[model samples]
Target: MKKPAKILTTAMIMLFSLVQMPLTQAAMITTGEAIQAQQRNIDRDNLLSMLQKDELRAQLAAYGVDAQAAAERISHMTDAEIAMLNDHLDEMPAGESFLSVIGLIVVVLVVTDLIGATDVFPFIRPVS
Candidate 1:
């Protein structure tokens, strides 16, 4: 009877050890990989949030456009157009600097005329 009880206890111990082995092996995987996977998930969530924001979608819709299409078009725009868009993005809608902006535009037009690239402004004629 004593021998049978000891054998049963030993078998139980072996079974418990076998069950724990895989859990220990699983923990040995690198923590960095886990963190990187979590960050990728978070970035995906943030991208979805930006795409689904109602205000942004409404602004894009006001132009008879879809937000994703507008974003794609802006991404593929020429550098000059991108710069203009950036400037527009930086402006406050209710701010009053129209005259200053108009003056700067006039100066640019004059310079372009002087350089003979444009002929729209007649005050400065390009040299032949």
Candidate 2:
């Protein structure tokens, strides 16, 4: 009986010590920062979704731009770079010229298009 009690007590003490240890290292995260990061991810995803469009993908293929490389590049870009690229995209209006826009978006965002802003283009609908 004493031997069983000693073994049980030792097990309980070990379990108690384990429980007393920190479960996980807590990291500080502000709500605003989290929301901003999430928004960036969504925006990046939207741009990637745009790339997946058949017309755009073919256009990219025609231009010899590798779609996979472009996506990988987005992951390494800084927040400011992403914001800048997104701002450019927001300026573009989806229209009959969507193919051209897609080409330019891929080219411009990836630093290969080297063209002027699209907002000034006659076809682009003003952000309303």
How much does each candidate deviate from the true structure in C-alpha RMSD?
Answer: 17.7, 11.5
lDDT by residue for model 2 over 1-128, one digit each (tens)?
99999999999999999999987888999999899999999888876777667877787677666666556666656777678777776676767355655565555543532332232233334343
Overall lDDT per candidate, in order of appearance: 0.53, 0.67
lDDT for model 2? 0.67
lDDT of 1 by residue, 93-127 (tens): 54443333333334444555687865544556897
Model 2 alpha-carbon miss at residue 45, Å: 1.3
By summed lDDT, the worst window of 10 consecutive residues in model 2 runs over 112-121
In candidate 2, residue 2 scores what lDDT? 100
- Candidate 1, run of 10 with poorest lDDT: 96-105
Highest TM-score: give the candidate number. 2
> Global lDDT for candidate 1?
0.53
lDDT of 2 at 59: 76
Clashing pairs in 2: 107-113
